[model samples]
Target: MAAIHRLERTQNIPIDLEQAWNFFSRPGNLEKITPAYMRFRITSPPVARMYAGEVITYFIRPLLGIPLAWMTEITHVQEGRYFVDEQKKGPYALWHHQHHFEAVPGGIKMTDIVHYQLPLGFLGTLAGKLFVNRQLEDIFAYRREAIEQLFGSMN
Candidate 1:
């Protein structure tokens, strides 16, 4: 069995909680923050807002432009506070992600916690150690820049 890996990131958005929540809650908005090189594209019908039990499907070229089909269901939602999305079909053995928003002194604090496990047991472990972690970091870095451009700087 592969070991479960965790990744968490938090950023202060220089925007009101409602605006932050509204932008992030829409499934289609993912493409705006994602790196263009990854070719992230949503296959599911466009949604204005997300709710529990919403199933989202996408095609992503995570590596070498090789397209992969990924599906995730919004398993939990608490309106503007938080939401959880769980993988139903994807490359990973498991994927559960939580998005949380809190109104802070300056702006909104957005947090992302992702728990994921790769497939193929030991081979998966090796791949994760060699590249997957770095890939995830790069993706998030891109997201931070994209979001900052959209919502202005937090500092």
Candidate 2:
């Protein structure tokens, strides 16, 4: 079995907690922050808000323009605080992502914590070391820039 890997990132957005929560809590807003090359799209019908046990599906061409159907279930939610999503079916052997929101000095602090395990045992470890980690890094970098664009830099 491959070891589980973790990635965490935190950023401040110049927005009120309610605004941040309102935007992030809506599942449809995801594609706006995702990179275009990934070709991310939600397959599930529009949801006004996300709640525990909600299952969301998406079609993403994250790697070679080959579409992959990914499904995630919202496992936990605390209004205006945080929410957790876990992969029900996806590329990773395991994927648990948590989005945290907290009110800070001037705006809201958003933190993302992701835990994932690749498949294929030793090969997965090798792949992680070789390029998977870098790919993840790039994805997060794009997300950072996209968020900055949407709300302007933290002021």
Which residue pairs collide in model 2, if any? Answer: none
Residue 105's lDDT within candidate 1 is: 88
State the lDDT of candidate 2 residue by residue for 1-155, as single tens digits.
Answer: 68989999999999999999999999888999888998999999977777999999999997789999999999999999999999999989999999999999889999999999999899889989988889899899999998999897775
Model 2 is weakest, by summed lDDT over 10 consecutive residues, at 146-155
Question: Per-residue lDDT tens digits of candidate 1, residues 60-94?
Answer: 99999999999999999999999999999998999
- For model 1, the superposed segments whose C-alpha errors exceed 4 Å read none
